[model samples]
Target: MPGPVMPDQAIGTSMRNKDRISAFLTLLPSIILIGIFVYGFIGNTFWISLSDWGGAAALAENPVKSYVGFANYLDLFTGFLGGGFRQDLVNAVFYSVMLLAGAIGIGLILAMLLDNKPRGESFFRTVFLYPMSLSFIVTGTIWRWMLAPQGGVNILPTYVGLPPLRFPWLSSTDAILLFNWQNLLPIALYLVSLVLIIWGLWRLKNNPAKALVLLIPGVVVGGSVWLWGDLLPQALFMEEIHGFNTATFGIIMATIWQYSGYTMALYLAGFTGISQDLRDAAMLDGASTAKYYRYIALPMVKPITISAIIILSHISLKMFDLIFAMTGPDNGQTGHPALNMYLTTFRANDFARGAAIAIILFIIAATFIIPYMISSYRQRRSR
Candidate 1:
């Protein structure tokens, strides 16, 4: 027993449908362009990575591409010729860790100092942030000169009546914390277990039961790995060692100098957004300035810290131009995946392997970004 629809209701419904159709039409072109360009290219690259499209005929007009499944990936990780790539991967990990620690730590300190409204704050902020305005190439070049073996930094010691140090900043052959590639499987398992245990400990206060679920499995796996690690199959047939090269210290220092300012700005803005009444309340409760920031202000700006970590992680992964300008591609001590990819593709004409490296980098980048995206989406939906 439905009532007859009103003429006004019908008109409004028709108008709403029309509006929906108009919006869809307006967005259709962008959707099409992105599909054919960004996603399409990514799909094509992935296909190339799985194909045998390399060698001398790779660049030919009618070049052949045959499916080879995951062979390229397998070869990169375990092949005899992939030692350089493995070392480069290790270098990238070290670079990411150092950059995250140095930039976030220094930036937070600077932000806290400025939050006190010190004299000449504006000038100091400008001075600290000036390096960020320069391109990576410029920063790399400047740092290269500063870190020279017998010049810039080395000469500073002579002015104070000390002998000029002759340490090779970019050409050093020394490496530390060496680990055999043959132990890769056990090492990887240990890392996973460590992560789980740390994560569980971090969440123990809020959700003890769930934390126990994580901790139990983590401890069991770690103990098992420690006891039976030798039983695990070796990642390679022969031993190959990799470690952190001392040569990359200069590059790391330069990167920290450039990006710390950017992070400082992010943290400063987050600090500025905190309500003054909250500060007064904290003071009334007898909270010292250090305790107020540590216990209250930092927790409020957790999102800012996450954002900085994500941004810096991405930059660290794609550290091509800076590394090239500072140490060049030939400097194996300071190599990165992006530079290695470029050299493999254009210089060595290995298209398939290059695509494989690209896809690996893309996957690594996604690991940092996808989690943040999912968290942000959840936050938005909850709101």
Candidate 2:
């Protein structure tokens, strides 16, 4: 009574307890999300992937219960996922690789241009980023209109007198590259790598001068693309550019265009965070543009590069909506990676195989996403 109940100092323990409870409350929603959305889905899918049932056919009180065990997995790994079991998995992998390469390569360049603040930087940035806000369906729809056989986009070539404008890019393989960009990705990276490796090897070899010519990294990368361009079918040459069935090509082009802007945004943000002083210092030391980007900018934004690659890979892995919207699920068994899964699951209502295919996609996404998450954790810790 003498000290008036010593208001504050009465109990530090109570305040500490209150603080702990508040911290737990603050994290409650996140914890719930991790449990339900993340862990729960993972567990549910994992169990589903192990079964022979899928879609509406998945639930039934049967005698033997099939006990398919890992048969579904074998079928998935082999070719049974699509019944005839073609190389659907391989095709998906290929498409994913293409998407990743296209997004990063074109995105980085576009991002750099946008960064330059050239005329209409805001407009261009929006044009590039707007797709990111829209659903893949929207992206597919818009591109489809542009690439349709008798669309306004095709008319431009005709109007300009280029004249090779009648192909439905998504249907024909002729405009081969008009939209076959999906395939060009791996090829592009291959070309770039080949040139670099060739030049670097040449440099490492006997003649230093020849090596110098061969070893210039840029030259090597440029040559690879030139060589690849030389290898496609002659009609793919432009005269044939407009006539061929380029459905596959169109898909490629669609993917490249839609995803590139997103990658560009990622790189742009990463670029801004880099210290301008370091870049200027490199310039002061007389570093060439190429060298400066290669050494200074590249290293500083390595995380962004990794982030872009990981993101694109995941996007490619789960790439269902775009493919479906553009070409529907018809050729999915062959060229449409997500096609086989969607058609089998929804239209044909083949749940078992469809879920299996989705599981396969999940595996792919996990491969890239998990590592990136781990890297992010490490990054946070370092900070």
Candidate 3:
């Protein structure tokens, strides 16, 4: 600390400081642009969601906007006229679950098969991935015809002397797993308890103390819900039933067919990066091919799986083009929140409600993305 700085050292420090200043100046424009455009638009959208901005006045040059707090959001959730939105929300949940399961499962299987290096591996890989090259609109149009009630899939049985299936693929009225919106509080609590209990059970062997902490609260909440759930106030004065509609089956099938190949490519890349020597060592240790993949390869590619889930979850949330091409926007049987938002804003001239719907979707997307980002940051810092 007492030594005087040498000429070369002092020059080096000065150069470093100058370089830092140059870098910051270069990045300043982009930072300002993003702040004004992206975050600014988001903030403006949120403000619109909290105001009254709809009807014929919405398109006016200086539309009168009055703050309405969370009225728009409340109306979407519990208002009598929100029945369609409620059903669409339920459909979105089912769509997300089925898409994640089907795409990830089929992709994993396809990747595993290709990893064996069969003859014509390149050709098979290309064939499997070809569907992903087409746009959603194209895929939806193709599947729409193939799923027609009397023409395509339904007529396959006729080739073997069986009568054509009479089941309607896109216009079915059947529904299952019905639940009342009136009992929303209890159902939500039950779901929370289930998630906690499942998570605790999964971690029980690894960290008993932490697991017990999660388990005990989960049990208490579940027991309270079971014992006194009826005391909770109903979300709606009238019964509003929602469930998985049978009509969405065809749309889901087409989505899986289109996206499974994309996920398969993701998994294949992850599998390819693994060291061959490591795989050989596992085989030498008496691990079967299935065990090698299930226990070794999968764990190594956890990042890839997480990435796929995040991407698919976002895609499922904003699915519009495919649903539109398969069943038009007016088709109540295959309605989605994105389509509903469009109709409410443009067709019905309800700008505030549309903004509310957009905010809700944004929040839901953040829920999936924020946790992943935080975890990734923590992991990098730890490393």
Candidate 4:
């Protein structure tokens, strides 16, 4: 610099600025895209939720007059024009919670088993994962045929030389209140029910009720034994129903089947990505399989496990296709989350309320996802 302040030295700084400008230019399109699509939609949705537009026609006809302040919001929370609302918001919360629990629980169990590497492990993995590939609509169709009250699952027990058993998991009043027992809140009723069941078991120790409780399991074993040996089906006239409360359980089962595979796949990849040396070191340190997985492998895979939770939680909230397909949404105006949302939106032509419901769903999904994403970002920054 003292010698000459040459052209080459100035050229370097000029080129750096040009490179920076070029990079900005390259990214400008994507920046504009994000601003319009993401930010615009969120803003517009919030605005729409405050209005009373009669679908889109009113939006075009009198855009200014379409403004209805928070009348839609008031109706949404209280009653639509004081019509006394019952929009199934409670049901949506119920199913969403059930779906969250079922998906995560089933997925974790399958992932742990898959990591164990039993015989036909790959085959079992495929069986579990394949369901996720199909759309819930397709899953609904398949399970419908199988769970059909008269035609499908109802015939299986009779064929196996047992009593006919039919459980209507899809379209019945078999609602299970997660918190509600005997229509009483679980928080209020659990101890009572637990005490009663325990008392019943104690009383049943010397009665036929002992055998009755084992009925379904016994039938399953007897069916297998008879099938293998061609023996007489000793368990006849089983005219008993098992797994009662079909509608509630049916939706739970469907949600579990759809999301379990996704969770397992996440675990699968997480396990695969761990370094071989770390595993070997744990083994050398006198670790049993269980200890090794719990201490060494599980800690390493915690991030993936958290990711699985967020994904499953989000999917569970918007659980429309599965519920709709499994149980027709119009089944007597019962409390089904998906059907409730759909009917509410269509009946009132209240896109605003629909958007409000959507925001609630978004918040639920964010409850799981946002925290995990933030933690992951902070971890990256520290490194």
Candidate 5:
């Protein structure tokens, strides 16, 4: 049988419990504050998105906010009022893809070059990262001036005895690689097939049998769609051409210039963390510089690349300030959902529709973020 606990020992135990209680109390206020401000607001926004609350009297005290289900979402996706919304959605998708590719690719190249320890490495690194130090508003304003149709970059040609280029940088209404918006099903199928094919090729050497299984279905579905896409039902009776807006080129250029330095910094840190002994061993094994990076260094720093992608992709989704500064509001050619959401809510007084757009953006951003979060969580669990 156990003896009675000593009074001093009991006091010590009680003191530890009190300390734990005190620690929890210290955190409770912050947790409550965050819960209300962050999650509570998010819930309120989602509820507003599902309600009928907009128009002339939306801002009035005690305004009517009746639940309307998904009417706002349906209208944005299919109704006549959705034309600008759809166009902005397309632009946002294209922007995210292009920005991710350009920033990550360029940043990786710069990181690799810097890893070579060239002369004046610190100066060059500073020069590369200098753009990131400037605010997006400043960057956008500067680029807007440079890309103005009659001045800046256009006039540089005249200095070389050439005609001044008259290309419209941000005001052009033209779009290239046009596709019918009504063919969403066929396009989706094609995209799915392309993903499968890429997945198969990526795993070809590791598991040829599984690769063949994925590849065959992808090829069959993709080829069938390519050859007989006309058989598919149209999403809409009317034809709508949506494509890459050339005007966005100026915006994309400015975005890449501003963010690539950040990605470079991430990749540079990753490269620096790599053991020099490993690089020396690769060199001793007759690995060329290209092969050294391709086979060794790159694979080691893939996490940095993935992190950069997630950050940049979400940044692309919420691209409002730069676009607004560059082209102002509602310039269909350079509009994004974020800009459209602002105008719809504040300027156009379509609060419900704006809320829907915000929800859509939230979902899109989640698509990039949630997967990475799950991956990180699984990695942590495995460890």
Candidate 6:
């Protein structure tokens, strides 16, 4: 009942199957190489992190690595010697937050200005983006000279017939907004209450039911904390003041200068992608420039904002070269996990502990990346 298959048709089908096999074979080597190199190394690193491999033995060619379950991690977090790591972690958090705020805010402003098609727009755009092309080493070296106590920025005030700034730019040890680490529990409770109250207020008009649900817990927690604040358990016997370090300001300034322009470019591209017709429509509707951008443009380019945050935050976490080039190693004010990891592994010959630090960093970075990945996946599924 079926028609006879033609030789040409059979030959064509065979050829296609062969082509697919050939194509797969062509890519097999690369896939195997990647699997062996990238994932293999990552797995080895994780194994090392879970082992006891350090000190003099770590530098030996035939180092003995014994399996130890999370001792290194525990030491880093709660050990007496880990004070530096804690301070470095705090610095990293502050750096990431400040860098994100400064870079995004400044970039948005620059993008808005350039969006108006001002005179010499191309030249200005090029100038702003030029800094991003420079390596961190170059940027750090330049900034180091500029931030020197007696040389660059401090002397500028003298040129204007004002007293030179004696304030320590890179060597200052003072911190502001200091809070005792012993009160972490109370502080955390207070922060939670504040967040709930803010969320309730935000939702009051549109979702009164949810607002009340949020507000009730917030009020109860806040009132409880106010009444029984002293009853909360202290995390430490002595008060440990940790706050924003003034010494990191110079590094922060240099980082902001280098990266803001890159964010500006991203925003500019986002702005360009927006249809002119939408702008015309907003204008016809009597929307001012500020309102148009605030209400329409920003909402449309939110993905770009999220991308910028993820990129900049990871960059902040991985900051070692710039910090090293600027301030060198062991400066608690500007020390990041990356630098600490290097010092631990190479300088101290503590391979296992270094591996633990690397894992912590990897986990922290994953915290930022994984959420975005899941959200993106969910969005795609929804579409």
- The weakest ten consecutive residues by lDDT in model 5 span 74-83
Residue pairs in clash, model 5: none
Model 4: weakest 10-residue lDDT segment is: 234-243
Model 5 has an lDDT value of 0.92
**Candidate 3 error regions (>4 Å):** none
Q: Model 1 clash pairs?
A: none
Residues 25-126 of candidate 4 have per-residue lDDT tens digits of 999999999999988887787777676655545435455435677766555444423222222444555555666677766776777787767899999999
lDDT of 3: 0.94
- In candidate 1, which residue ranges exceed 4 Å CA deviation? 1-19
Of the two candidates 3 and 5, the one with more favorable lDDT, higher being better, is 3
Residues 313-356 of candidate 1: C-alpha lDDT, one tens digit per residue: 99999789999999988999999999999999999888989999
TM-score of each: 0.96, 0.70, 0.96, 0.70, 0.92, 0.87
lDDT of 1: 0.95
Q: Candidate 1 vs candidate 2: which has greater lDDT?
A: 1
Instruction: Residues 1-383, candidate 6: write the lDDT tens digits.
Output: 98999999999999999999999999999999999997887778888999999987787889888999898997786666786787787788888988999999999899999999999999999998888998889999999999998889988989889999887888899997777776878988998999999999989999999999999999999999999999998766666677888999988988999999999999999999999999999999999999999999999999999999999999998779889989999788878888999999999989899999999998899899999999989999999
lDDT (CA) for every model shown? 0.95, 0.67, 0.94, 0.64, 0.92, 0.90
lDDT of each residue in 244-299, candidate 2, tens digit only: 22355666677788778888888899888877787789889999867877777767
Show the lowest summed lDDT stretch of 10 residues, model 1: 148-157
Top model number, lDDT: 1
How many pairs of residues collide in model 5? Answer: 0
Candidate 6 has a TM-score of 0.87
- Estimate the TM-score for candidate 1: 0.96
lDDT minimum window of 10 residues, candidate 2: 235-244
Judged by lDDT relative to the true structure, which candidate is superior, 1 or 5?
A: 1
